[model samples]
Target: MKLLMMAACAGLTLNTAAAQEMSYGHAEYLNSCAVCHGVDGTGDGPLRDLLIRRPADLTQLSERNGGTFPYSRVFATIDGRYAVPSHGNREMPVWGRLFLEDDAKNYGPSGGEVVTTERIHNLAGYIETLQH
Candidate 1:
């Protein structure tokens, strides 16, 4: 009946939304992070050796972080919040602010915290899938 049709349509809509969100994250990684991190998240890109502290081997993150990847901490570090002191300075750009600016430019008005949160979540999700 009409109720069933409506539910089906709603589900389809949600699925489409989710797909779009995932695509954005994938695109973002491909466009920005992949240059340094490598497409396979191995940190073996051409610029890897140029970095003073060396890019992280993301696939081994869990082993490096006590058998559990501290995702929140990783997200914070990627977003340039929790600085690695031994890295010798903030070498990575603050992605949170960069994403906010990009969102503002794309949406006319800034999406503010929501967009930042989504970007972080999406990036984190992408990173989680990199674990070996």
Candidate 2:
């Protein structure tokens, strides 16, 4: 997790928008999930109107799961191992597979898997913090 946070910070540049105002996970969320889940995880991003089904209200994840954040499920969801209908076929997660491929190049096989898992864990932790 620390390694991933360092990597996230290393990728940031002085020209980035409101960099200091955002935490690493928040920045990650904005770069990825926020496009479909919204800044507050309310399922009302710009693409909401264009999709066949509404994105889940991420903030309600805990509420919907007996007041406990479904950590492993969320981790699996982000990792693309879980079958999310909106994300399309499990065999090919167009979005996440791209990241996996890129990570494989940047970090190699074992390292990339480690990095990817850490990223998923970090992102899941961030989502847990957002539960209301």
* Top-lDDT candidate index: 1
**Per-residue lDDT for 35-99 in model 2, tens only?**
77898999988877777778789999999999999998887777775465786554213445656
Q: Each model's TM-score?
A: 0.70, 0.75
Best-performing candidate as measured by TM-score = 2
Write down the lDDT that model 1 would get.
0.77
lDDT of each: 0.77, 0.76
Model 1 is weakest, by summed lDDT over 10 consecutive residues, at 104-113
| Regions of model 2 farther than 4 Å from truth | 1-18, 82-96
Error of 1 at 71 (Å): 0.9
Count of backbone clashes for each model? 0, 0
**Clash-forming residue pairs, model 2:** none
Q: Cα RMSDs of all predictions?
A: 7.9, 9.3
For residues 23-120, could you state the per-residue lDDT of candidate 1 as single tens digits? Answer: 66676777778777888889886777788766777788888888897798878976775466787776567887787777777765555557776888
